[model samples]
Target: MPNTIVELRDVAIYQRESLVLSEINLDINKGEFVYLIGKTGSGKSSFMKTLYGDLPLTQGSGTVTDFDLRALKEKDIPFLRRKLGIVFQDFNLLPDRTINDNLLFVLKATGWKDKEEMDAKIEEVLGRVGMKTKGFKFPHQLSGGEQQRVAIARALLNDPELILADEPTGNLDPQTSVEVMKVLQEINRNGRTILMATHDYALLLKFPSKTLKCDGSKVFEVVQKNV
Candidate 1:
């Protein structure tokens, strides 16, 4: 069987005092590209937070990139993050830094100290996302699509086992969204497992995969045709 990157069985997700999702059972294997779709306030963010060690997993059982969600500790969060990459709706790049500097900052923060090695790794990732020539440009210098590409490049720095993208294209225009989607699709095709949470149904129809839906306090898999 293929190796599972994310597995949750009978899981429950919460936001502060209230429960948001219950009875969640999911299996995302290596090299799979899955889509997470739900309406606003439908526990999508809560579910993503649970996976990334933001919200504690208090009920059921779950594992992400070999880390037990139920047993994850504050100190362990950084290590867990190294094994997984997270992309948010906002680019989150430091506005004061150039794209290359932004990526370098993450590498240093993650304990990469060798300048030559870091530079080589940065080049590799930027090339993968079609932004090798634009690394010196500031965040504001690039368009939304380019900024998102840089964000994706930043996520790839650690060679993560899984990538969690939350509304990655939510801020871009329709055409720019397609560009970002194509970049993501290319990454998936190259064997990186990705779970993207989005409300963009048009993208669903354009590039369908194993889809999961969060609705009515539950998370379940849905066939692409029905989505």
Candidate 2:
């Protein structure tokens, strides 16, 4: 049996009282690279948010990295996030900190107390994303793509069971987008399951995978030809 990393059944996603997606049944298995494609307001972000606990799952049953969505508690959100890595469109790195400090902050916040272990982990993840030499640079010192790569490396610090990437290439130019995509592809190749939400159909053609489309308030799998 395939190990399922994310599963949702009869799920309804919302933002406040507004219903975003409904009757959503989906399964993302271990080592799978899945895409969530939709228009700007078609609930792709909301769907991703629900999985990562940014938005609550109030109308359905769901689980992410073994945490029940509906049953998730306030204190549990942090722990839940620790098991899952999240990459955002905005590259949410702390501008005031260097790349090394940015990653260190996460490790410290998550309870790593050993200095050597934390440094080793930061090195490993930065090397994975090809940012090992640039750790001393601040966010402003790198290009958009480079900054995004650092953000991706930060996401990997926890060795998450699943990665929830929301438009990771949204802020990059065409060429740079492909660069960041290559980094993500490499990470996924190494056995981490990734569920990325994006509207970039061009990327779909360049690097096709199992895709799900959110439309008319519903989510369903779409074959590559249809995507």
Candidate 3:
């Protein structure tokens, strides 16, 4: 077992030749839940993008889930992402698809062939997230929290080692936000490392963890607690 599942040593990221994150050094271990908090345009999303291989590395070395991000091939991008689960503030469910279909789509894309196995996997994850009943429901029918839970189930479909969430509760109500956080916490308890970017300070204080703040083209810990 590796102590560090995500290692970013002296890594730099750029968009359109403009630097976004410079010299970011991070060593995130397995089974850790890290709260990634930062202001907008402070490279929170950009950093997440880098972790998921959406942005090309302009400088330095990076490795996510044992794959060299700086040296990642186009064909390997999909494989790299298979080890990562991402959640966003906005629920990105397919409007035309049911919850079960959405999960099935991901399974098929990731090489899950047997319908029985796929059905069992889908049922298992949805049950774990407390949305097994809502699996037949459409995205629009569920509440914001329910939809986000489905999104979480989708992210877990590939059995990802890490989760990179960007403001996952920004659009939900207070009670619902806390509920979603509980579900995320439950997932983290099951040995998945989660790095979530959020603007919700109340939730941060309520469920404090290793906090990283991105500002002034730098990313660092907020306190010794983060260490």
Q: Rank the candidates by TM-score, best first.
A: 1, 2, 3
Which whole-number lDDT from 0 to 100 does residue 86 have in model 3?
Answer: 88
Q: After superposition, how far is residue 91 of candidate 2 from its true place, in Å?
A: 0.6
lDDT of each: 0.95, 0.93, 0.89
**Which parts of model 3 are misplaced by more than 4 Å?**
224-227
Tens digits of per-residue lDDT for model 3 on 1-227?
37788888898888878888898998899999998777789999999998898887768888899998889878998999999998988989998989999999999999999999999999999998899998888899999999999999889988999998889999999999999999999999989899999988889888988888898898888873442
**Residue 132 Cα positional deviation in candidate 3, in Å, after optimal superposition:** 0.7
**How do the candidates rank by lDDT, highest first?**
1, 2, 3
Whole-model alpha-carbon lDDT for candidate 2: 0.93
Off by over 4 Å in 1: none
TM-score of each: 0.98, 0.98, 0.97
Q: What tens-digit string does per-residue lDDT give for candidate 2 at 1-227?
A: 34988889999888999888999988889999999998899989888888889898899899898899999999999999999999999999999999999999999999999999999999999999999999999999999999999999999999999999999999999999999989999999999999999988899999999999999999999999987
Top candidate when judged by lDDT against the true structure: 1
TM-score of 1: 0.98
Instruction: Please state every model's RMSD to the true fold in angstroms.
Output: 0.9, 0.9, 1.6
Clashing pairs in 1: none
